[model samples]
Target: MLEKLIDDFKLQPPHAVLLALEPLRAISDYVAGIVGPAEALPRGDGHPVIVFPGLALSGAATADLRVRLQQLGYELYDWEQGVNNWPDADFDEWLQRLGAHLQRIHARHGRSVSLIGWSLGGIYARELAKKYPKLVRQVITLATPFTDTGDSTHAGWILTLLNGAAYAVDEALLKRLSVDPPVPSASIYSQTDGVVAWQGCQGKETRCHRNIEVNRVSHMGMVHHPDVLRVVADLLVEPC
Candidate 1:
């Protein structure tokens, strides 16, 4: 299974058609939220939840989902840092800030906080769980490429250009990042993802780990997808 997943990770960029359709599909999903029937999922316990946006985007990219989660009784918090531009600063410094953010949330809530990250943010979420397992209740990723970063993303060239030497992914790092987090985690991906391949998004699923797929959704649209949001809500309500 590992070998198969790795082979599948020889990722390809999204097709022109899929890329072209992203805006329309995202708009449709947004419209559906208003005109379609809402799923009656159970409410959250008001636990503090922090959401991280994707690469090159901002916390505002996740606002819709965060607000939805908040409406469901979860205490939503932003990453605070404006845009997720990987090129602007040192990765280590960015991680330090995340660590501090997690600490603040824990201090305020008196409990481990759940983490939700999209794309690159998901990679951050997983590493955070590994470094501070006791402080993270659960981790949820939307279209995050974990198996191999370089080969998994359609935006590899962009990352290479922006991150320069830091974007390089060696075998040791790939093997390490592919491992599951110590806490409960789920990877939500789409086979037709236009940014990263679905195979790289999958990890070894165990009792506490899961890989979920939705049909016909773009990578960018995963953030607002109704089904994916439902899965996140369900996972958050589970016992810690």
Candidate 2:
């Protein structure tokens, strides 16, 4: 069944030309974040929030977004795993470690923690929520292509370089990733994303799940785009 879906999906990565504009668009987004009307953004309830960076990115990459969240009254935390190059360790081991970290945070706060993740990191967020649903309040994914992990993303070469010839799609994993976590979740994506296919970034919307579509935001800019930030802020404060 997974194979049939893969065959029929025909997912393709965003155009190379569009990908080329990623850096410039990201810069524009950063600038827009600076002048963005954040005063109107909703405030959080001082709950703990952990942010997971995208593939090959470090906590620094999410610094701006974290700062914004912190200013909005949320206790922000880094993934503390340095760069997100998971190839250095066993995949299951990585997840176990993250789960343990989430457990500690939940225990410390005595409340469910919200998780915000970008790109591949979003996959981790969803999986952790699934494994430890009691510890998670909600989840928000930015430009994460959790539906199909085929060549639908331009990061395939990076994966190949990280895992070498050993890199192969796990159909079961893909299917599992596509499922929404038990907690309330929102996926913020853009049709103009220039890294992963937009289709792969969306899933069926239910009462507990929603898909938000932004416009003209580069994949790399998802973290700092003003529109993206506003949507994230609104969802974070929304009652589950």
Candidate 3:
């Protein structure tokens, strides 16, 4: 059943209804943010943390979570790359820019940084870890699809639309992308995720990599869901 879902590029109409409820869930998370305190998780050790927003979203999408992490005493930074629209330009050039940005963050901190990415941003974070393991202390991914990339995701059509006809990811790259990062990493996913298939969000169980599951969290709400936030906090404070 999971394999069949991954082979299908589209989601059922029922899933659309779940996606529609995201705005309300987001509002509730916002309320939770206001009424709750940052001490829900232990304070960080002052390491710099950078957050990457999901596809078609700007850093603003992660503002709430970033603020929470900030209050938890970690130096927080945004991707600052504007919207994560899959552009029509040379993909390598885009990656080069991203790599340079990560390099700059490492240089400035004078210590390895931790990366937290939401959805497509998580893919980028994992790839960065693959390329720059020494610069990254750990990684956290929220509701990211890794198994089949586009096909396994309910947002596959959106990716096809934005990324165009050449949007296919070869099997080799997919295999490479799904591997555990050199540094400690966690993939946080929700069984009820309305966007990506749950199976694709999993990692090989190992001391260095694991999948953390949350309940009743919408795909879009993962960024600010209280339970997801707590899990991220726990992962962040783990010794690397």
Find the candidate with the highest TM-score and give its number.
Answer: 2
Query: lDDT of each structure?
Result: 0.82, 0.89, 0.82
CA displacement after TM-score superposition, residue 57 of candidate 2 (Å): 0.3
Which residue pairs show collisions in model 3?
none
Two-way lDDT contest, 1 vs 2, winner: 2
Model 1 lDDT per residue over 1-240, tens place: 999997764656567677677778877767664442375867999999999999888998999888889989999999888877652545556677788999999999998999999988898888889888999999999989888556556666767666565466668767777888999999998987777767889988899899988777778887777777778888999989
lDDT, candidate 3, at 42: 88
Q: List the candidates' TM-scores in order.
A: 0.88, 0.93, 0.87
By the TM-score metric, which is better: model 2 or model 3? 2
List the candidates ranked by TM-score, beginning with the highest.
Answer: 2, 1, 3
Better of 1 and 3 by lDDT: 1
TM accuracy, model 1: 0.88
TM-score of 2: 0.93
User: Best by lDDT, which number?
Assistant: 2
| Residue 165 lDDT, candidate 1, scale 0-100 | 52
Better of 1 and 2 by TM-score: 2
User: Model 3, residue 66: what's the lDDT?
Assistant: 94
Shift of residue 18 alpha carbon in model 2, Å: 1.0
Query: 5 in model 3: Cα distance from truth in Å?
Result: 12
Give candidate 3's error at residue 2 in angstroms: 15
